[model samples]
Target: MSGYSGTDCQIPSVPSSFAPGHGEGLEDKGCGNGTWTSVEQLVAVPVRPFTFTEAPQTITAGGQYGVLEYHGSISKPHHPGEAEFYLLRGVLTENEAAQLLATCSQALSEAIGSGKGRDLDVDGRPRFAVEVAELGVLDGKGSALRPLVETVLLPLVRQKYGQTAALSSACFRRFVPEERRFIPPHQEYDSFAVMTIALQESASYTGGFFLQGSGKAFVDRKFLQLGRGDLCIFQYDLCHGVDVQEGSHLELVLHFKDSPQAVADGSCPWYSKMVEVGDPDGLFGHALSLVKKDFPAAKEFVEKACEQDHVEALYTAAEWFWDSPFGLEESQNSSASVELWRRAAELGHCRSRSRLGSLLMQGVPGRLQQDIWEGKRLLRLAFEQDDPDAAFHLGQALLQDGDRDGVTKLLAACAKGHPRACFQVAELYREGQFQFPKDLRQSVRYTKWAAHQGDAQALSNLGHLLINGMGVVKDEAKAVRLFRHAAKLGAAEGMLNYGLALLRGSGGVKVDYQEALEWAQKSAALGHSLAHQQCLGGSFRD
Candidate 1:
């Protein structure tokens, strides 16, 4: 249940020994030389195969050269993982990223098509303008992509790095023109790295050169450009980027970090049981990101959340577990989620109490043991807590138990503002069972209330009352309207009634055979017996 917290910092460069094959010869230019310690010392170690149960943090710090520092703990440390970053202050979430990318790509394409900003680079390539926004998460399309990144990518990085690592907040910004001049030699210093996968192809724009850094000379360096989904990983300290030139701006940044945790023995319980099962691919990182996005106390809880906040925490944990195939046995079928609900119910969490009561009532085959009396008791508890659904259920239970007074009292309480309860009262009245008087006026009132709540069944019932003149004065026009509304809401009986109304032109309504046929067809599709017979020219319709 460990959470994450961090602060952004700016560090001056400290000269350090050049790691081989990390562009050793090139002069350290942009940010001064700094012998930054291993990424392990900087960030909190994580439990391997992490499944984030909460949201991410939102820290605001801006500068050409600065570090966003985060502090958080994982259940176990030795496992490997990867982290994704996004610039929250500038634009929010993936929707914004898609919009910005689409706009910039389109503009760059138009400029190239119009023969503007199409000058050739030093390599005689057409130049195009591009915009680059760094610090963006690749999977911001929605909650759907979180599973993919958390389950698939982080484990892969961990495997390659041999240990878990911390993710940096900085994303890259590279605006490359179609011209060759924009390509610049670069290298990084982190032990392992990965780049964001772009949704669109690079060829759609002009003057985007991805140059691989040559440890050789600074001025005359060799480089290579990349296409979407292509990744480049090397020693942590390689310099890379596009040489500034006119073209569409592109964001190209690499995530850098060192192994954060010490590797554990394969058989350790915490490592094997919790860390492995809990975070199979470090999904917890993404979960943190989501928690940050949705909840207000994301940063605080991520940094210090415990199991006591189990209601929200367990729900998030359940979601993460449900999304991944790894650790299915331990995480997916969590007793924690059920226990959390039970605890909340005990604490008078109305929704949780209602849900627990409903679950008790269901007696899920092979999961929940059957106990109708217990279910009724729970439902009654929830009903007393003012849960509308619980009240409705309690009424049904009491009615079945031959407790007419109890049923009437509970139903009345829910019926005041709850449509389902109102419908239930109408149903009891219509049946004339349990010694309840079949008052047409009361039936119509309750049914009307349910219909107003958009209950299709109630609307159909109201239509029947109006058509038969059972409650209020007969009004075929009103009946037809009710029927049509119910039919639109997918009420099969309503379709049949509306069709019949159209066919007969009853109650001052117009006759339309075509419309009647359509409604009849729909009703038949929904298994309305009379409508089906009518459509098939059987005896029922006549």
Candidate 2:
């Protein structure tokens, strides 16, 4: 493990090698030679502890460096809103920033391994900027992130918002200069608040970190110039985005949701404090905490918030009574669910309106009276606001009425990667149903889209097409792979097809008759009649 005797440390920004419990000599990278050991996590510390940045007012200190809240503006206010985000300077030392950056790089590499989370072009995401992997990855357990989140970040949240929250997820965002990556102004639809730390110096990148006016705030549009070891904090309610014009920008972003489990006792004084101070949102958060713990008391809390006209709570309360958890209908009161949704819909809650309208149109048995006219009206209102589910539901209703416009609406939802919508359009194209003018190519295209979004049926169907060279060029090898994946996803047809493939050793796969029998048995058990016929009728791949 012998390495460098250098007194100066420049904090290398690249990640350490993935191998654990060993030192890799990094003389070539030249931030001052050192071995990266597990002891330092991602840090390749020099022989001695050395300070990097001087002082920006030392309110926070850990041995050598001081972290202070930056009171000055990060960017000039361009829009009509107050600054939605604030910064803390000197939050990490050069070595620590390097460590954090490495951790983020490795985690993102693992989670986003040649895969995409969002459907392409669905959210207007630039192909280059859409590295949206599922956050927290759960398997990683945020172990590498615990010290940073629990110790460094959550304390800042408590200090800033007076709200008790915990880490729900974390994601890595790397804006590559070669890819010309950048993010435009948009509020996060996913998290309650966001904490992002710059893993590199401000000079490491250019033209990034800007905020815009959103919600009730009169915040001016401003850009932040963060140095190494700096922290930026804000609620997702605040409109913000990033812009990177030059070098690569590595950001370790953490999303925190209001969780009572953030505290050991599953309770927090700040929630009550906010509630007592008349913030209904606090009561809503508390109710969610109770619901997460399956405490029946959550029901009363949610109802109380609904009484205060809390829009979100009203919508949730309806759901609470409408559907039983995991089919335990004993707790469900569809009648009560309809009442709450009716109230929320009257207040212009889009989802509530859509749900209530669908229930009314279908006539929920022994619950909602049939009211198709009012139902369609409410659905149309929500759809006019571009609610995708509303379009899908209304399309279904209209399709039952033999309306051509129904397919058009379904097409709109399909474009948004709605699986049912995609599957319906695929079927229409395949069978010329509903005057869709049978286009097998369109069928294949839509089926591919559905499969990419993880539709098991579409996956099996695509495999079927590949096997027969229908619409798409035949590739039995690829087809078999798709069948295997689909079968793993629990598609009964996929199991049947995969079993046949295995029995015949099709597409370079070794023959495994035993495994084939297993898959055939599974598919037959799942009620795939064709599966039963295939094995019994001697329909092997050959």
Candidate 3:
């Protein structure tokens, strides 16, 4: 075929296969060959068997012209899948590679350094590395090749090998002189394959040998050096890494397999050992890794646990997936947890219903929101089912919505045995906020009840009442005891109040200037503005 000049590269001026004006602007003018004429129509043309030595063929048929460099292909051993690689040539420079590597490495390093990555790990240990693929997406380069690789090349590989295929990348410091030796030695996982191709040549320096797993004896020592257009394919369950002898840089295009069952099975050889040893984070890090690796089967397995007949199993699954510190976008898995809890709730799991209701009420962005009405309804159901926490939440919701009658009913039920409910009832009665009578006597009654149950807030409230003689005779000694009790419960507000009482000698008590100053300072540190100002000499004087 004769090469076409720049002007000749344009579309034909006159339509040759169809009537000149008949198919104008018709999105898909069907040709007799069953092919659509529109540029938007994707027709999967079978790729011709082009070897590495053959002239580079346009994988994207009927498209623009560009330089291409071929990388070798790999055929699946027991499967029919095959993977090939090619470099779409452009003016990519070493500086760009270095900058991208440095930026990605720094970000990963910072993430690991800041405890975020550690928090993401179940055991709170650092990962080998955080591999972020799809850098092209973040860079805004719009690599059309990604889709081509995913849709066409990946499917072709899977079809040829009879196993699934995946594509991913990782940021590493292979180019950094000091960090070159830290490259992964070699490792393998089951029923998986990997193919990596260098996007740019690194003959300028050294190192980066793509070695295959030889045997159990000496895994890390095996090495193979590959050039720009060379492709390295191996089983997923093998150990391998580039032994960078001396290279300025090497940017790779990577393809691998993402096992659906691996998610549920947690069978990744690389991480299974970590899970077995009960690594510091328990199953958390491994589970998160499975999620990150897109092990759909593992995800299904976890989901299945939520669907179990046992309430405990369902609750466990929900909590496990929901609280997983791994920052997998909440929108992705939170809905699954929500659905699980909803199912459990429907099955008369009161605790599950309460949990689901709370999640719904707090609404995660792009997931659910805090629906006060729904939360109240769910909490009411749970309360009817005799769940104390549900009663507390129902009463709280009612109080917030100014539902005086509902709040009174729920709070009364909750206060029957629940100390928290007693405190709430006392607060409502004291403030008369939810249409309750401002009965200081009843407030003191419930506050005393809650205080007996060891509630710090209740004790503090009771102390205030006693000192001010609001519902009882002013008793400085009694108020001091209550304040001290609440302060002992680690209540910051209680500490501040107790300090103030000690300092000013309130309730017919003597004023100790030094003690008052110390307490005021403590309260101020706890964000008590009045106490803070008092410490600064802004006190009530005789």
Candidate 4:
């Protein structure tokens, strides 16, 4: 290969001995083979020094090579955000670039093959964003790239971002013309800064450009071009995206977050910090680690983690926000949940897509903006993925829109043993809501299926059907057992029903006023109105 060169960038050439085939044992892994293999032996580290210089004159408008909008601290003053910009110019030895590219490609292929990688399209194309630690195969000596990060990249980051910034995450990103993946503009959080290192030969690809701006509106944007071994560093929260007009693009992205000081030992094998900090997944794991140490509030941890390019965290955090699991305020939770779900959905989390669809279908006056068309599109995407929950929710949404096939979708979910879906099917049979006529047998059957799966309401309702022989053979003893099971699971109505049955000697059980009173009192404590009334009236076995 010819010596590396770039516009306005000077890089030294490597000796011919370091070329692809010049070294012994280097022939084990062939280059450009298009097949990824495990790293059996550690390859010798290339001795190439990377260097760069800042431009003397900065231009404002187009035709300028590089300009910075923000630099110093990454976050906004007083508030919690920051941005920084740096341009690095260097060229890797041909052999080093080839080895690094091969390592990343193999890691990506393995992740995709093992189902750890996210699918961008229904055709099973992999998403550009990949969490390196999530692959589970590459760790410590297991990864050929660990030495590169620890020995080479670590000190560089510390020199640039200062020693206070902790290593947050590293990801492998690949863009192919066939996939035609265009990342929409988005901002990062948790990370103080992000560094992008080019691995592929830039001249080989056409029409791939990187853009970053201060605001979501691309009013003022800076486009950066990086050659092989070149890198760029910028604030994590800066609005950024990639536009691929043609060929393939590949890069390695490393992020840093402002964190408590730790020993900055470059030779200490920094990748091991991933395991020690419980951030092996490198999705929300970094923020989750902070939450574990009480370094940040749970809500803040989730908020920051969700903002990073972690799609799985976006989905899980959306659910957490909607469910108010970590004590987030309700109004904020609902809005944040929907927004996060939308972001995750856009990034192609099928489940998140379905959830956003459900939320959009609601068309709630203020909480979630309505977009029926978009909602249906997302729901269909999820439904095609065989997600039972998505099928159940989409079926309901379609039914509300007067699509009769929604019933079929619900039944499909029920067939998959989705407990809530089974309950929905049972309700449809019980009420004969759509075209189907009322069928007590079908209702009882589906309800039983749900109850067996620990659906609390199903247990109570099915117990009633059993006691009254509403749709099946009467089995008072079994009814009592079901009610008791439900009550223990914190079903308030189940508690009241069990108390009443025991008090009246119903369900073929011997009457026990003491047991009945105790159950009634517990139900009353749980705010069951009927149970409260019975307890207030001191009426057991009345």
TM per candidate: 0.39, 0.58, 0.37, 0.42
Local accuracy of candidate 3 as per-residue lDDT tens digits, 373-417: 677677777755445566666666554554433454444343233
For all candidates, the clash counts are 69, 8, 35, 5
Q: On a 0 to 1 TM-score scale, where does candidate 2 land against the true structure?
A: 0.58
Model 4 lDDT, residue 241, Cα: 53
At residue 361, give the lDDT of candidate 2: 85
lDDT of 2 at 467: 74
Candidate 4 lDDT by residue in tens digits, 67-98: 33223222222113445566555524456657
* Candidate 2 residue 522 C-alpha distance from true site, Å: 6.7
After superposition of all CA atoms, the RMSD between model 3 and the true structure is: 31.2
Evaluate residue 481 in candidate 1 and report its C-alpha lDDT on the 0 to 100 scale.
83
Which parts of model 4 are misplaced by more than 4 Å? 1-283, 286-308, 328-332, 363-377, 430-433, 437-441, 469-474, 487-496, 508-541
For model 2, give the 10-residue run with minimal summed lDDT. Answer: 1-10
Pairs that clash in candidate 2: 78-221, 79-221, 81-218, 81-219, 81-220, 82-218, 82-219, 92-229
> Model 2, 402-479: lDDT tens per residue?
554565567655533456566667776666554345678878877776665566777778878887788888998888
